[model samples]
Target chain A: MLELLIVSTLNGVLFGMLLFLMASGLTLIFSMMGVLNFAHASFYMLGAFFGFQISRWVGFWPALVVGPVLVGAIGAVVERFGLRNVHRHGHVPELLFTFGLAFVIEEVVQMIWGKSPVDFRVPEVLDFPAFTIFATNYPAYKLFMLLISIGIFVALFAVLTKTRIGLIVQASLTHPNMVAHLGHNVPLVFMLVFGLGSALAAIAGVIAGPALVTQSNMAALLGPILFVVVVVGGLGSLSGAFVASLLIGLLQTFAVSVNVSLADVFAVFGFTPGPDSMLDDLWRVTVAQIAPILPYLLLVLVLILKPSGLMGTRET
Target chain B: MKTTYVRGLAVAAALSLCSAASAQESIKIGYVDPLSGGGASIGEIGLKTFQFIAELQNAKGGVLGKKIEFVPYDNKLNPQESIVQVQKAIDAGIRIITQGNGSGAAAAITEFVAKYNERNPGKEVIYLNYAAVDPVLTNDKCNYWHFRWDANSEIKMEAITSYMKANASIKKVYLINQDYSFGQSVRADAKKMVSAKRPDVQIVGDELHPLMKITDFAPYIAKIKASGADSVITGNWGQDFALLLKAAADAGLQANWYTFYAGGAGGPTAIKQTGLNHRVFQISEGFANIPHAPAQEFEKALRAKYNVGLFYPRAVNQFGMLFAAMEQTKSADPKKIAAALEGMKFNVFSGGEGFMRKDDHQFFQPMYISSFGERGSGEPLDEEGTGWGWKLVGKIDTGSTMVSTTCKMQRPN
Candidate 1:
């Protein structure tokens, strides 16, 4: 039991870190722009593909640095030309624009890379076991992911709280007109924030691509979960996003590891289902069986119970 | 003036005759499958394979002296989209429709074709399936208009179980599959057959995950590791299969995998990355390494032309049988071709004879259990740029893999 707990907890933290890398960017963009960048995960996919291509040419380390920069540059261009143009139409248009951009980016990715998963692999340097617990080997790549995520969090927090640009950006989030009146380039700050957020998503993608399967549909696969993290954590709260990411990651991991079934629950209540019972499926349900949907269940409950989210300042 | 009028009339008559001749010389076959979205990796290769085969057949004077024209319609891997595409194909005067990437899409097309044929007798169309392997497509839900070339999931599992029974080292097994009709059937069949054949083997875990939705399989792999399973049986294809194997690799889980499609589009790369060294196995109708000279020559030619491996030999077999039926009947009519294909026996290029059972319209042939390993001296093929080739480990004869089907067909007189 202790071994399982240790392994599950480690797995949860590792997965949660990756989720935070994605959700932090999303929540930051929401907090600043008040528009959900639906194409955030798509940018992550672009990062992986770009990284894969660059890794083939230059190697993994260089690709890791170059891939996210290229993606961020593309994000900046989109902000300068595309999103800025759509901004005047209000939040709905911006949301719809990003939504459509996600589809376009996916189709374009397919056109260039085809529909198959790329052969993105962990570097040989990080391929061995970091440690072993309870006869299971903990991969070095997973630990690397944890460290990278932690580093990004520290960097982001330090930048947002300590720097002059961060101060202006934070001010604009709450007082856009006031910042503009202070003779600061508010639009430029918004563009910079969007670009950085997108770059953060790209970094997550470049790192997670090999760990997860890097395919064209990868954005579609991880996009919803990132949204859930942002919403459950509170739309604009980075700390809330952080807590929610770990909560979901651990909750799902532990749930999948435990093999308890509804039948066990029924037995605890002194009830036994007959062979002809209509509730046979319910009786047969296991915690592991429903682990995938636990995050969504939490999302629904949070929406119903706390409309502003756990740490959200915004009223929905 | 008289001579000028005579010359004009002669030219007009000749032009009409030429147009009629060209129209009668071409036969259209609609290729409906996913050309976009998640299933496109497999479907694009399938479409290209059909196109390449059609071009080759046409170059050799076509089928029954009519040029084989493959009309591709993108279904996007959706059932509703497939049905709409079939209707569009029919409207364009296509009488033969072929599709087989997703079993769900194939099932929808099969049922739609059957009902359409029943409603409109003379304008009937035949559905040729080359990859979808749901047993119910041939068993309970079988239709007269549908003919499946690929071995169903049950037949493939039979071959796998027989191989497992021979290997005594495999004591504890786990089954993980996507939660869908084809996946469920594979899980059910694996459990039943493994239990029946090797009663001593214990099933450590049975897991069903959402199809194509899992981004992280580490948790699932953790559970499998905890179970102390020595072997895994999975029916997952596409990304699900690839990602599951990736998770296993990341966790350093050492277990032999007997899979339905570990040779799928991205699967070989994942297997190679795992560096398992022949521990991964797949059961299929044919592999790229099958030692048949003509088959090798054809595969080589296809690779030279398309830069893709012949992943599904069943597509080649289906086209071959279709051409043979057309030649036997000397007609492109759907009814005559269906009648000719029923109970048809033909020598396959891969060293055996395949039989099309009349009752269920299911094709049965020899299936092989192959393992991924270092390429031997004479082996000329590999998948996904992986130097490791699939080596044949065991074979199940056509007769042994046959299962009794409960299909009750209503044929058009």
Candidate 2:
């Protein structure tokens, strides 16, 4: 039991941090532009593919610095030419534009990389065992991932809270006209923020690509859950997204470890449904079987009970 | 007026002759699978294999002097999309349909073809499944129009368990599979078969996660580590198969993996990445490095042409039997071909004679269990540019691979 608890907690935190790495960008974009950036994950996909290609040319070390910059530049261009035009036509158009951009990006990536997963391996330097807990040898690559995620979180927090550009960008989020009147390049600031948000997503992709499957449909796989994290964390709240990522991550990880079912609970109350009962299948379903949907369940509950989210200042 | 009427009758006769000539041009088979999306990588390989087989047959004076042409239709791996593609193929006058990526798609195509064949008597279509291994397709859901070339999940489990029964070292086993019909049946069958065969062996854990959705499997690996299982069995394929093994390697989980699809498209590369040596095992009809001279030659030729090793040797069997059936019937008619295929025995590509059971249309062949590692002296071929090859350890002949079926297929009058 102690082994399980310790292992589950560590797994949950690692997973949560991974989620935050991806969700942080979406959160940042929503806070500033309020567009939801459906194509954010697509940029992450682009990052992985680019990282794969670039690492093939140079080593992974150099590709790590180059891939995100290339994807971030592309993000900046999309904001200037694509999202900026759609923004004038209300939020729906903006949402639809990003939504369509996601498909376009997926198709383009497929055209280049084909539908199979590219072989993006962890660098040999970080491939050894980092530590052992309860007979489990956690790889150094994952430790590197955890450290990168934490470092990004710290850097992002410091940039937003303690820097001049961060203040101007935060100011531009609400008062674009005021910032423009004060002689700031408000449009340029918007573009940069979008690019920076995308880069954050790219960073996650560059790091997580080696650990995960890095396939074409990877964006779609993690897309919905990123929304759940952003919404549950409270819209536009960085810390909220962080807390929500960990919560959902822990919830899913621990849920998989638990073998309890409705039948077990019902048996405790001296009630047992027969095998042919209408809900027999439901009764027999263990918590672990439904671990994937727990985040969506939480999303629904949060929407109903706490509309602004666990840490959000605004309701969306 | 009588002269004009005679002219019109002559024109109609000429048109009939032209239509008759067009009908003998080619024997078009619809290759319906995911050719454009997430499943495309494997699907395209299946397509290429069929095309290669068709070309080989065409080079041998064609089947009954009619060229074998595979018309590719992208189903996107969706069941509904597959049905639509089948309909499109039917409209294009295609009489043979083949798909084998997902069991759900296979079941849908099978039902669709059966219903279509029933509704339209003369224009019947045959659905030939190449790789979907769900047992229910051969058992409860069996249909006359559908014929499966791959062994079902139950038969695979039976073979694996029998092999495990003889291996006294395997004490505790773990079952982890995708949470779906195919995955569910694998775990259930593994437990039942293992318990029945080796009662002393304890099942340490049984787990099911969402299909193809999980990106991280560390927690699952940790759970398996905690269970102290010596062996693991999974039916997971594609990314799920690759990621699970990748996670297991990262955590250094020392367990012998018994899998149904560890030899799939990207499988060898992932295994090589783990450097697990010979720990990972897969049961399949054939592998790249089968010692048979003819099979190795075919693999070599196939790799030379497409730069991809033959992943579906059963597909080679599928087409080989198909051409044989056409030759026996001496026609390209779907009904005649289906009749000839029933209870047919042929030499499979990897060796040994196998027969298609008349009761369920499930082909039974010799199933081999092989481990991935650095090639032995006897093994000549490696997979996916990896130095590691499948070293054949166990072979269950067609007789031992057989399991009783409950299929009562409805025949067309």
Candidate 3:
């Protein structure tokens, strides 16, 4: 039991860190632009494919740096040319544009990479098991993921809270017009923030690619869950996103480990369903079976009970 | 008045001749499958294979003097979309429909085609399935209009379990499959067969995950390790299969995998990355390394033409049977072709006889169990540039692999 607990918790933490890496960028983008960039996860996919291609030419380490930078540049150009023009038409158009852009990006990726998983393997240096807990081996690549996510979090926190650019960014979130009046290049700042947010997502993608499968559908797989983290963590709060990511990760992992079913729950109430009963599906439902949907279930409850989310100051 | 009557009869005769000539020019077969989205990689390959065979048949003076024309329809792997595509195919005067990527889509098409044939009397169409392997499609839900070329999941599992029973090294086994009808069937069949055949072997873990939805299989791999399973039997195809193998490789897990599709798209790449040599195994109707000159020549020509390997030989088998039936009946009418196909026995490319069971419309042929390893001399094809080809390890003859079906196919008189 202790071993199961320890292993599940570690897995949860590792998964949470990856989720936070994705959610942080999404929350930042939303807070600054007041527009949900649905294409955010697609950019992460771009990072993985680009990183895979670059890794083939120059190796993994260099690809890790160059892939995100290239993605960030593309994000900046899109913000300047695509989003800026659509921003005048209001938030709905911007959101739709980003949503459509996600589809286009996926189609383009398919066209170039084909609709199959790529052979993105972990580097030889980090391919061995880092440690064993309860006879379960943890790969060094997972440890690398944890370390990179932590480093990103610390750097992001330090830059946002302690630096001059951080102060300007924080102020612009609340008072963009006032910052512009004070002689700041507000549009340039917006472009920079968007680019940075995308770079962060790209970093997550590059690190997670080998661990997860690098396929064309990676974006669609992770995109909704990342949004769940952002919303459940309180729409625009980094701390909220972090907390939500960890909560969801642990909840799902622990849930999967537990084999309790609705039938078990109903038995406590002295209810037994017949073989041909209409409620068979309900009785058959297990905690492990529904673990994938728990995040969404939580989202709905959170929206109903706490509209401002767990950490947001603004009304959602 | 006599001159006018003569002219009118001449015009009517010419019009009727033109209509008959146009109809005889082509025998349209509707190719409905995922031509886009996640299933497109396999779907595109299937489409190309059918196109190649159709061209070959046309070059050989066509079937019944009518050129085989395949009309492509993209379903995007959706069942409802497949129904719509089938309707469009029926509207376009296609009497034969073929699809084989997703069992769900195939099931929907099979059911729809059966109902459409029943309702629209003379406008009947036949559904030829090349790859959907859910056993119930042949057993309880089999229809007269539907025929499956690939062996069902139950038959494959029976062969695998028998192989396991013979090999005493397989002490503890694990079952991991996608959480769908096909996957569920695979798990159930594996458990039953393993229990019946090798009662001494312990099943340590059984896990089912959503089809193509899993991104990271590390957690699942961790569980498999904890279970200490010596082997795993999985029916996951496409990205799910690729990703599971990749995760196992990353974790350095050393259990042999008995799979339905270990040589699927991206599978060879994952196998090479793991460097497992021959630990990965797959059971299929045919593979590229089968020692037959004509089969080898056909595979080479396909690669030269399409730049893709022959992943599913069942597609070719399906076309070959259809062409033979067309020639036997000497007609393009679906009913005549269907009657000709029933109880058909023909030679397979792998130097064995294949028989189509009239009772359930299931085709049976020699099934090969191949292993992934270094490409030996004379092996021409390998997946994903792995240079590690799939070599045939075991063969189950058509008679040994046959299973009794519960199909109550209702024929139109």
Candidate 4:
């Protein structure tokens, strides 16, 4: 039991950290723009496919740098054209624009990349086990994913806290009108933040692509979870986003790691189900059996228990 | 000399017309699937196989002296959107369609294609299924316009049960399936198989999950762990199959034996999952690890073009059957093609070549049982460590004869 818990928790932590990489960028954009980027996950998908394509021509390192850069540029263009046009309609409009953009992006990707899962492989250098527990070896690539998230987190903290541009960005987040009056290029700042946020998402995509099974829906699959993370952490708080992401990630990872059915609970109480009972299948429900639903359950619970979220300063 | 040469050439050309005259007609076919999703591996291989055959046919001077053109589109497993693509192909006058996708989407096309054939009998929209295995496709729900390139759900289960009876000591059966039509039907088959073959075998657990939404299996794994089942039967395919093996191993739900009817069950993904957990025989149709000489050559040509090999046996099975249908029908005429395919018997060159059951339009192919070898110790070389390699075992035919569950069904002549 202890071994299982230890392994599950470790796997959860690693998965949580990976989720943080994807969430941090989203939170930053949300805090700055006041409107959630519904297509943030789509950028992540772009990063993966772009990186996979780039690697074929120029190899892995170049893809590691180029993939995110390309995705960031696309994100900036999308913000300037797609989102800007829709910004006038209000927050819902902006959100709806991104949603439509997501569908369009999915189609465009299929057109360019063709329909097929690229046989993506992590570079040979990072291809060994980083750690092992209970006879199970954890791959170096996943460990690298955890490290990259942490590294990005640190870099983001440094940029946000130590730089002059950081001060202007923070000022804009608090008072966009005031920052605009102070001769700040608010739109440029918005573009930069959006680009940076998208680039961060792309980086996460590059790392997770080989691990999570890359496909057209990779972004859409992560969309709801990332949204849930942002909402659960409190829409406007970075710390809240971080906490929520890790929490949800770990919750899901662990939930799927172990299972025990409801029948066990019934059996303990000396309740035996008859063969014809509709509850026959239920007598065999397990926590691990329901792993897929755990994150949403956590989201609902958080929503009910703390409307402001763990570290939320703003309310939606 | 020039006059004599000209006369000789003219006489030789006139003499070339012989006893068996080759038929002629140009036809266009369309291929659709989520070629870029988690299931892309199957779709991609199927496409390559399609191309190889198309190329082979074209090189021999095209189908009916009019080259066959196969234009493929990506559906990405979206149903409503897939219908749009199919309609587009239909509008462009594409008569024959080959599709391998989720059952829901396949069923949607069935109604559309039937109507398509009815309205435009001049260009009958005949469907050749390569991957969708819903029994309703060839059973009571079957339409005369559509024919399956792959086996039905009941046929695959028959192979599994028949192989198990001769192969292992499966006493207790625990079924874990993705919750849907195919999953439910697979569970039903297993239940029936147990009752029919080994009534003494207790069914300890039966579980279901929504398709493509399964994230964890610990609770189910824990139940199965406690169930003391001797073996497991499932319809988990692709990513679900891969994830389940990891979950079972992680949750320690090891059975004496396990059986599944999936493209990935005996493919690379299963091999990867088995590496993480334990040894497993990924039950597959067709017993060959790599198919015969013609199939191996086809695989080489395919890998050269697509940069990947066929992971699912059905990818090749469906390709071989459809290509064979097109080659012999020789005429791209929809009615003629349908006529040729009905009661079609051709050597598939991929081990035992099975005939398409005329009554039900199901392929009566043999199955392959490939056991996944354990993942070697030490750190995985990148994602390759998760690689699952399958080892081949005995081959058996599931009695390719599909007994029609419906009395109303009849063979198309």
Candidate 5:
């Protein structure tokens, strides 16, 4: 039982951190753009597919560099053409536009890749056990993923706080008109930020692809979870997104690792098991069976607990 | 006399006019699948089978002299995602759509089809369900436009339940399934079968595991151990199966020890993980090992065409059925094809008498049960010749495995 907790928590933390990589970009975009990008995780998926394809021909390290660059360029184009055009119709239109783009991108991906799970292997150089707990070896690649995520976070923090461009961009999110008056090339900055956010998402996808099972539909799965993370962390709050990302990651991770039920809790309270009961299934419950519902449950709980989310000024 | 002659000539010209029929344009078939999402592996196999059929048809110059193109939409196995794809297929002028794999997605599409039919009386988009196993699709809630190609719940479970009664000694039974339409049907059918045939087998415990994201199973394993059932039966697929099996193994749930899992893992993913030839007891479909010319030929061509063990030959179910239908009809006309497919005993060049029961259009065929061996405990299932883990356990006939549901709906022969 102790082994289950330690392993599940550790793995959960790792998984959560990977999710943070994707969620961070989404949060960043929301903070800067003042509108939610529903397609954010799709970019992450694109990153994984791109990384897989490039690595297939060029190798892993090259994909690390090339995948993000390509995806970022595409993101820039999408913002300039797709989002900018739809922006005129209002926020609703903008949201719908990105949503439509997500579906179209999925089809395009199928057409190009031929609908199969690609083999996104961890680079041979980094292939080793990070450490083993309870005779189960933790892969080195996962540890590397943790390191990369932390490194990105540090870099993001340094840029956002320490640089003049970063300061201007941060100011523009709140005072865009003023920033434009100050001759800061605000539109160009927005385009660049959106591009960079997408690139970050892609980079996360590339790194996490091998570990998380690199199938094309992986994007759709991540999209909702990332949305939950953003919403739970507070919309447009980067720090909030970060916390929520980890929280969700750990919540599901730990949820599936241990077994707890109403019946078990009831048993402690002197409730005897009934032979014919809907809760009979509950009596035989385990953490794994309930894992799929944890995110939704968390979403509901967070909504009830903090309507404005963990750190947001906005409530919807 | 001259005026009469001219009037007669005009009447003859009018009477001799041709029917003025138009040339047949290519039939655009839309397919919404999880080509890139969690179900991409499945979509991949389905795609390959589709491509083989497409190529073969094109080589022979298409059906009814019109080409068939499958316009694929990647719905990623999400219901909402499929809604968009289905609409897109409609917008793109596709009159026929085929989908399956995600029951929620299928449910959503079926509902849409029901509304669409009511709105448009003259034209209806035909829905072909290949892999979605929800019983609701065929029930009273069924849509006029939808038809499933796979076995329904009662039929599929009856196959397993009847087999267990006749062969296995294990009197005890436990039920485990995912919490979904397909899972519910599996359990419902299991309950029906056990009560009717093996009443002596005590029903110990039944459980529902969630879909997709189950990563651990120790607690469930402990509970199952306590259930004291001699056999366990389940209907689970995707990552759930992989995780469950691994978890069961970790918790020392030995093979065929306390469980007989029907559906899913004994499928494509299972075949890919290990060679079926090498396990102590293996469950597989009839297509994988039947030594027929067509089966052998398909195996040879498929193996030579792609990476070994990337996909299983069972993917050919759709193509096999489709080709047989086309051959009988020799046309892309829906009415003719539907008439031909109903009550059709089509020989899928692979093996087994693949039957398209006139009732619900579900194909009932015999499946295989094999005994797989390995080098030792924990070794992968072998796939080399007879040495591979899987052995022939004889065929389960369509008559014994699944009864035709044509009686439920009367479509005239």
Candidate 6:
């Protein structure tokens, strides 16, 4: 029991960190631009594919630096040419633009990489066991991912709060006119922030790709949970995204470890639902069976209780 | 006036004769499966396999004096899309349609074909299922128009559990599968069969995770590790299986995995990467490295030409029976072929005697249990450049592999 708890906690924190890695950039883009980038996960997918391709040419380390930079450049170009024009139309068009962009990106990735998963292996240096806890040998690659995620969180927090460029970017969102009058390029700030956010997501992808299945549909898989994290964490709030990511990660991980069901609860009261009953499915479903949806359930609860989210300054 | 009328009649007769000759040019079998979207990876392979089989058959002077042609229709792996495709195929005058991939699609196509045949008597269309292994299709929903070449999921579970009965090492088993109809059935069948076969074995855990939705399986892996299971049985395919095995490897979870699709696309690569040599077992009708000389020759030729392994040896059996039935009846009519196929016994590609069960139209064949590992001197094949091949461990003969089917079909008068 102790081993299980320890392993589940470690797994939860690691998974939470990975989620925060992807969601942090999304929160940044949303808060600064007020345009939810639906294609954020698609950019992450591009990172993984790019990382795989570049690593094949050089190695994982070079791909780690180059893949995100390339994808970030692409993100910046999209903002400059595509999103900039869409931004004039309003937030709906921008959201729709990113929505369609996700599909197009997925199709393009499928066409180039094919639908099957590419073999994106972890670097040989990080393939060993990082530590052993009661017989569970956690891979060094996961520890590296945890480290990178933490480093990204720390770096991003510092940049947004403790840096001069951060002030301009933050000011550009709410006081674009004033920032522009103050001789700052507000549009350029928005473009650069979008690119950096995308780069952060790419870094997550580059690290997470080897650990996860690097395939075409990967974006579609992670896309929804990302939104769940952002919303439950209070949209546009980086710290909220961080807390929500860990909360969900722990919730799902701990839920999966538990096999108790409503039936067990009913059994204590000396009642059992018949197989033919309409509520039988609900009664019989174990916590482990419904672990995937627990985060969404949390989303519902949070939205009902606090519409602005756990820490949002404004409602979305 | 009489001479002119006679000449007009002669001209009309000649035109009809030319039309009849042109109509017998080729036999077109509609290949209805996903040819686009996420399912396309396997769909393209299925299409190529059928085309290759047709190519081989047509090379031998064709079947029943006409060349075999496969007409591809992209269903996009949707049940609704499949019905539309099948209707399109029927309108195009196709008498035979084969599909496999999704049981939901299979069920839709089966019902469509049955109703179409019932409504249109002489223009009957036959549905040949290749890979959708839902046992319900063979049992409760079986019909005369539908014939399945692949072993149903229940049969696969029976085979795996029967194999497990022999292995005394498997004291505790973990069940992890996708949380849908296919995965649900696999879980239920595994539990039922394991208990009946080896009551001494304990089921430590039964987990049904969302299908193809999970990115990281570390949580599930940790749960499995804590359960202290020595064996795992799963019907997870695609990324589910790959990611599950990957996480198992990462956490250093040591357990023998018995899977239904451990040889699917990207499966061998994942298994090889995990270094789980001979530990990841799969039960299938046939694989590339089965020690049959003729099948191996066929595999080599197939790989040399298409650069893909013979992933569906039952496809060979499917076409073999198809051609034989056509030859037996000396016709290409769907009704005649369906009749000739019932309870027909034939030699399978993997060197076994197999037959189509008349009750359910489900083919009965020898199933092989193999594990991915480094090849011995005798094994000359590897999968997806993994430098690892499936080593045959057990072979369940056709008779032993047969399970009872509760099928009652209404035959044509």
Error of 6 at B113 (Å): 2.4
User: Which prediction has the highest TM-score against the true structure?
Assistant: 2
| TM-score of candidate 5 versus the correct structure, residues matched by position | 0.69
lDDT of 5 by residue, B74-102 (tens): 88788898889988998876767788777
lDDT of the structure predicted as candidate 3: 0.87
| Per-residue lDDT of model 2, residues A139-165, tens digit only | 899889889889989998999889999
Looking at candidate 3 chain B, the ten consecutive residues that score lowest on lDDT are B35-44
Using lDDT as the measure, which candidate wins?
A: 6
Clashes in model 3: which pairs?
none
Candidate 3: segments with Cα more than 4 A from true spot: A1-7, A53-62, A111-114, A118-137, A265-274, B1-26, B374-383
Task: Flag the better candidate by TM-score, 4 or 6.
Answer: 6
Interface C-alpha RMSD after superposing true interface residues, each candidate, one decimal: 2.1, 2.0, 2.6, 5.1, 5.5, 2.4
Per-prediction CA RMSD (Å): 3.8, 2.6, 3.5, 8.5, 7.4, 3.6
Tens digits of per-residue lDDT, candidate 1, B1-413, equal: 99989999999989989878766768889999877655767777887788899999999999877899889898977889999999999998899999987888888999999899989988889999988899999988999889999999989998899888989899999999887788888989999999999999999999888777787788888888888999999998877787788777777888999999998877887798678888999999888888888888888888899988788888888999999999999888899999999999988757699999999999999888889978887677887788888888888888898998999977778
Q: What is each candidate's fraction of native interface contacts (fnat)? A: 0.62, 0.75, 0.28, 0.25, 0.30, 0.68
**Model 4: per-residue lDDT, tens digit, B379-412?**
1111223354445555665354355656144333
Cα deviation of B322 in candidate 5 (Å)? 7.4
Residue-level lDDT of model 4, residues A178-265, one tens digit each, is 9999999998898888888899899988887766656677777788898888888888677777888778877776665454777777
lDDT to native, each model: 0.88, 0.88, 0.87, 0.70, 0.68, 0.89
- All candidates' TM-scores? 0.92, 0.95, 0.91, 0.76, 0.69, 0.93
Candidate 6 off by > 4 Å:
B1-26, B34-41, B71-78, B88-94
Query: Candidate 1 has which clashing residue pairs, if any?
Result: none
For residues B183-207, what per-residue lDDT tens digits would candidate 6 score against the true structure?
8899999989899989999999999
Clashes of each: 0, 1, 0, 29, 22, 0
Candidate 4 fraction of reference contacts recovered: 0.25
Candidate 4 Cα deviation (angstroms), residue A286 = 6.8
Q: Give the range of the ten consecutive residues with the poorest summed lDDT in model 5 chain B.
A: B257-266
TM-score, candidate 2, is 0.95
Candidate 4 lDDT score at position B126: 78
lDDT, candidate 2, residue A48?
Answer: 86
If you superpose only chain B onto the true chain B, what TM-score does each candidate give? 0.93, 0.93, 0.93, 0.79, 0.77, 0.92
| Model 4 spans > 4 angstroms off | A50-112, A154-168, A178-191, A254-310, B1-25, B61-65, B79-83, B114-124, B162-177, B191-234, B238-344, B351-353, B371-392, B398-404, B410-413
